[model samples]
Target: MLTEELLTLAAAAGAAVATAAGTDAWEGLRARLGHWFGRGDGRRGEAALAELDGSAAELLEGGTPTGGELERCGAAWRDRVVATLERLDGPDRDEAAHDLRRLLAEEPTAPKIHSGDQHVQGDIRVHAEQGSLAAALINGNVHFSPPPPPVRPEG
Candidate 1:
């Protein structure tokens, strides 16, 4: 049972694994993550590295794991991270979380599009119908309705 913070960090680790897939940052991030999870054990690091590679491969097997696929990937990574966190203590856990955050910070989360109120990501080609929804350009090409106007309260 991981704390909420650790769980969130785990999710970040998962997202980093997915977002960095097929990019140059993948290898470095993977190595760093493996070493961190390994916690000074070469064999442990290698095992973690193998698991990371497998996760990335599985997520990208069909296509860019977007939507549900992406969610699953993130969940899977979170579980692995949680398991690792459970086995660690004090400095080890802190260091692991810090390392995971560093990896996440170094990797940018591709791009996202909003569907109604949802933030969706990846190389999605939006074909939004119904009025000017297709005119929203985020990060230069993608489009959405700017997440709807903020509601104002009584004056």
Candidate 2:
């Protein structure tokens, strides 16, 4: 479980970023935080963690101009993330995983949208049944690109 303070800060940070810079920036911020707090990383620090948490909370709640617009906002947010991770060690760092999970869960979830077509519905059903693929999609890794197969050499 995550502490109330931490969850509040994380949620606020996410909301603030999205509100200020649009959803693209918010998703990037989440990914960076997730990477930092993930358990597998070997790096550790204390001051960095505290600073990040503090700065994030402040930014989320602060009513400043968020000057330099997107650039400053992005830099400030990134700096806090780096600083906070710099302060953690061992157990504290490990515990960041739970914090991140809770923070990520705070992002508003959207119901999976399905196409009305039968083929699309079938594809969704099939992919949703695959654990790994489903997890990736659920985590927002679903991307748009050319469909696989049927390639031809160009002159």
Candidate 3:
């Protein structure tokens, strides 16, 4: 059983993880999350990173953006975070909760973007820089395609 504070921390971590997916904040969050759960273990960090990636992919193509799947994933992660916190005792748990709070504090300000239901008689280009392109439909039709990978600058 988690205390109310721990429960809130777990929920915040879960929601922040979900919200940060596909955004610029994701990589930083991922690394910090990996370190948090991994505790300086490389293998554990990689595994945690993979899980985060999988969650983002699933949420993107779940056919119900911002729907039940989101809640389900959030709950799943909340459980996982709570379980991790449970393993720690006293000062360590407090430290873990503080780390979680730090991570959640980095969440970017997400904007509500709704396409369609408006006049789109011209070209519509939605450049959602450093944010999630969620719940945006094309021509008022549902398109379940994942956004393309970000282009990297060549050095």
lDDT, residue 6, candidate 3? 72
Query: Each model's C-alpha lDDT?
Result: 0.64, 0.39, 0.63
Off by over 4 Å in 1: 110-155
Ranking by TM-score: 3, 1, 2
Candidate 3: residue 80 lDDT (0-100):
83
Judged by lDDT, which candidate is best? 1
Where is model 3 more than 4 Å wrong at Cα?
Answer: 62-64, 109-155
lDDT of 2 by residue, 1-155 (tens): 43334433333443344333323334444455545544455353343344444444445453433433323444455345444544666677446634654454344421121222111110121124345653223433455543222112121
Q: For model 1, which pairs clash?
A: 136-143
2 against 3, candidate with superior TM-score: 3
Model 3 gets an lDDT of 0.63
Error of 3 at 108 (Å): 2.3
For model 1, state the Cα shift of residue 41 in Å: 0.5
Error of 3 at 14 (Å): 0.5
